[model samples]
Target chain A: MSGSVLYDAPGPRARARNLVLSVVGGLLIVGLVALVAYRLYDKGQFDGAMWDIFNYAGIRENILDGLAATLKVFAMAAALSLVMAVVLCMGRLSDHKPVRWLATGFIELFRSVPLLITIFALWVGIVDAILPVEVNIEPMWALVFGLAIYNSCVQAEVLRAGINAVPTGQREAAYAIGMRKTQVTASILMPQAVRSMMPTIISQLVVTLKDTSLGYIILYPELLQTARLIASNTQVNGDYPYVPTVIVIGTLYIVLCLALSGLANWIERRGRRAKTGIAPTEAKVPEQTGALP
Target chain B: MNVLLDNLDLFREGFVGTVSLTAGSAALAVVLGLIIAGFRVSPVPPLRLFGTVWVTLLRNTPLTLLFLVAFFVVPQVLFPGIDSYLLAVVALGMYTSSYIAEALRSGINTVPLGQAEAARSIGMTFTQTLRIVVLPQATRTALPPLSSFLIALTKNSAIAGAFNNVDLFNIQKVLSNEGYNILVIFIWITIGYLIVTFSISALFRTLERRLEVAR
Candidate 1:
């Protein structure tokens, strides 16, 4: 703590100021939202027939198809990224000077470079130079490879921190038990490190999911890009539907992320339950009673 | 050498865009991040949930996507005819704020609980404890990661190139496309990024040193 708080809570004057600020802020938000709606409305996005287009058979099919592609690409990129992360992590942690330096350099270099540049460069390099022919190896792959390369560096650091957080005594105990270095790393250290850093790991995965949208820049047609195409296609009265479509699309992203967050919370709770055996409510009850003191 | 000499003006312009965007958005983001971090660790369940959701959505989403979403999709959806520059700021600010929230939250977490408890024992309100007591310490600990995120933010602004904006990478792209000096232009852009990153890292190192000396 640096210093003591000068005020208790906001007094009336401060509260009034806060209220005014909030009202202004609220208006700004609502005004922006209204402007978006008005643009869409003016463009006839809200036309009677257009509103029902979500029920259109072809549009529904297109959304599903798009969703499938989004999931497939995200899954592949995420898996490959994890494998690369482990490799990079191991390399960074290695005792060998050359390996460590190479890993560190690669991590820092890729991590510093923009993901879009990586993907664009990789796409051009592979198609124009690396590959024998004009093969399209899923621009989505390029995006993922780029995402994975950068994120693996981040994951490697996270894992390294987790590994370092483990007590030296644990490693010594493992060695004393005649465990090989590999056994100590794989069975003991890695597991504990991963468990401790599970939240960070999960958070990174969320990043992976969001990064899937970057595929749009290369015309890979991930969710946001597809939504843009849908919104802009003149068939939907150009401007108005673009806003609603984007809102719907953004909301979809919010929904997916929130679902993932809920899952993380569930896992955290289950883990705590497994450890304590007593329910959280029951655990809190004792604390509440002790609060009397 | 001729190419570098000829394209110097464009390089300078691009560098300006990158720096301004990074600095402006970063300042707003740090403030927003502090607020979100407060919400994240707040006793109010709803406030905490709001903060968590914010971090999750913004952090998980790709920065480029958010950039596009903010620039194109967000304004198009929310306020049909909002200014592109404002949209850019809003999107970048929100996206950057999420990462700041994460960095700050971790920083806050690292602050010993006793610090806050001691503040409370001294009769400080929750906001008081957080502002006067908690945040200053968190700020120091969070500096390295914050600087790292700023570097990341600067690099990510390269996506502004895709938007056809006159940012550094886009400027380089334009110069290369027009002059056909591809390698030099890209090398220039790369150097520009490295300079930004290295300078920030150096600044952080200096700050860390000063902090140590003060201690």
Candidate 2:
């Protein structure tokens, strides 16, 4: 029904042609899936014993531990990244040209580099080489710092956009009230900016959560790494449990990301409800017009 | 500096590998994304469901997990003779295509209902209208986000380095193992990535400016 505006109702011949195309497409997809499954079965990936490895208590414990470790790193990285985001956002919005340029350069440089390389470099170059042995740098710390560095830059951009979204009249009114620049930004601008951008901020945190899996490259005992260790070390009929391990690990990631997005959606809905609950008609108009530019 | 000079060949090979991997995966992703986007907007119910399900599954899972499946499970079970590089390309392509499809679908939504209605009134078939009038405008608006996705893909192609692929990151890893200065090596690799990503950003910026619709 929604597409009715795009085209006229299909005639008998056109409808028949559409039906044929759909059937063919459906068959092709089914055939492809069947072929892949058959190949997997032939390779013993579907053997009951391949999946039985997860039945062991030790394996379950290992997975839980890995999950916990991943969450731990993510928690630290998320908090630190936000703190750094605030600092970088402020610096980028600084009054001094030199300070702003430096902050901009740092953000752009880190943003452009791949997260994997950043983590690897932090692990091998700075933590291993420069940190004093007495300081005891861990892979966990390296990963945390690396993730924070990249994510903070991204968060700064999001925050900056939110700040820019605030209307010019608000800033002018704050200035007319004899407020200092810092006072205006801190009190008048930032709170409103963060409230408006809360959804974007939360989604970026979801990105950070997924990015924690990248720690596996540096031998961090994260979920994916644990899956790799278990799959390669345990054997069933002379074959590793690669299929089952990947399936489990991938499911865990999917669940975590989906939950995070669900939370984001809930927050966004609550924000919308709060606004419209007060002045339904007034709140709706600005939102519609805000999206125009 | 001397470390870089001495290992120029290794670096060059690694650079070429990175470029090829990014290019291969990006090309595959664009095609798959277009198909998925088509499925999403198609009049058929099942096709729309399939598109929705595919995007949700792929978009939620981490790229590293997909790579693990590709490198460890897929090759052994399905295509035993497939090289690690190709497997990496497939993994990156599949993962990135989900994002690309979402971007394209959003772009299509921006194509005004009036335009489509006009095309239909002029007796254009769905396919003809999409191909001739809709997609061109959709792609023009989608250019910025599509370029961002490609840039992200280039960065992610480094994950392939974790496998046996001799990409830039892998070469840097080998250099560090051979007792090269870690800081210097990291600097060079960072610069390599920066150059590629920035060039992509600049190219897209230019495209966006040139393709701006005249009001």
DockQ of each: 0.30, 0.52
**Alpha-carbon lDDT of model 2:** 0.83
Report the C-alpha lDDT of model 1 over A223-257, residue by residue, as the tens digit. Answer: 77777677566355333355456556777777776
Task: Report the number of the highest-TM-score candidate.
Answer: 2
TM-score of chain A of each: 0.80, 0.87
True-structure Cα RMSD, model 1: 7.7
* Docking quality category of candidate 2 according to DockQ thresholds: medium
Instruction: Enumerate residue pairs that collide in model 2.
Output: none
Question: For residues B15-119, could you state the per-residue lDDT of candidate 2 as single tens digits?
Answer: 888888998999999999999988888866667778898998988888888888888887777778888888998899998899899888878888888888889
TM match of model 2 to true structure = 0.92
- Candidate 1 CAPRI category: acceptable
> Residue A63, candidate 1: how far off, in angstroms?
1.8
lDDT of 2 by residue, A1-293 (tens): 26565557889987887788788878887888899888888889889999888899999999999999999999999999999999999999998999999998888778877888889887775555655553455789989999999889888887887788788888999999999998999998888778777777777787888889998899999999999999999989998889888888888989998888777777677777774322111110011000001
10 residues in a row with least lDDT, candidate 2 chain B:
B192-201
